[model samples]
Target: MPSLITPVMPPGSLNASAQPTLTIDDLLVRPWLGSDAAAVARVFQEPMIQYWHLRKADSEDEAREWIEQWRLGWESESACHWAVVNADDDRLLGRVSLQSIIMVGGQAEISYWTAPESRGKGVCSRAVARVSSWALNEAGFNRIELSHSTTNIASCRIAEKTGFALEGTRRRALLHADGWHDMHLHARIGEA
Candidate 1:
């Protein structure tokens, strides 16, 4: 039953230590805190966020549960979510995550959302770049993918800015509230 290539990264590579707190200028990309529940809820209420991300927190409790799931994701190696906060004020600015992680394959999919006021200020892209670099160079991931609705021009720009090359378009790949939408798949491969 074990006649195959070795796992690119063994289990516990991520859970063996504390989730890293990454920094870029005034921004701190750290693990989600329970106190961030309210801020997380508020951001999900944004029309654009809901339209694209396809979920709303609805309440602080629900947000807390989501935060807990992200915490558990670190141990499970299924996902990693970081809350992007301003170092000076500790205000929530955005989120970046690696979803559908596969340690044996050393791969994951990147997802992100920025608060309304933080948009157009370079926060999301900077955080994404930092996190993606960490995942590729530090965390032993061999490839990280980013996909967005084809119509999401802003997301397309962010993916390109973070060095994720356009792979291809997946027809009707994702289902949002409106309907099924074609998605553009972008990816960055790492030496690890």
Candidate 2:
């Protein structure tokens, strides 16, 4: 698949041998495009991703179709989905999204999943911290929220590392493959 997350700089005008721009804070969080469908879809097939996002994406054809829908969502301002790319090789590291945006309420939630190979390397924590800071400092958001199944200890750790306060649990909030599962809700509010 072609690159989905490129530096925010003007495309098609980059200099040769340029350092790979990684993300928003040395990371480059940008949208998934047509060519990214295959790779991004493969992520969905991972067992961990399926548990969190709840879809295996089955095949590249399905991923392509999802990308089409994603284009519509982006143009309509319904979502801000981005692929996490490495600063060196520009390889996709993972994906992140600003889901359920509420303009009038000045609120949004962030969700992300790192590639299986990228787990346990502080990638998700760094991404969450950087994005949370942006939500408060750059985006002027009053609140940001994220949730995970109670069994997901790793994600809970990521929340803690990123400064997300444990708000509470919503019993039976998530219906995972194992059946109805409780979810721990977490939130971070900007200084108002």
Best-fitting candidate, scored by lDDT = 1
- Tens-place lDDT per residue, model 2, 59-150, is 88898888777555545444456677776666777877667765445466788899888888777888788777866776556788988889
Candidate 2 global lDDT? 0.72
Candidate 1's TM-score reads: 0.98
For model 1, residues 125-176, the per-residue Cα lDDT tens digits are 9999999999999998999999999999999999999899999999999999
List TM-score per model, in order: 0.98, 0.81
Q: Weakest 10 consecutive residues, lDDT, candidate 2?
A: 12-21
Model 1: residue 53 alpha-carbon error in angstroms: 1.3
Q: Candidate 1, residue 22: CA error in Å?
A: 0.3
* Candidate 1 regions with alpha-carbon error over 4 angstroms: none
Q: After superposing candidate 2, which stretches have Cα over 4 Å from the reference?
A: 1-26
Please provide the root mean square deviation of candidate 2 (C-alpha atoms, Å).
9.3
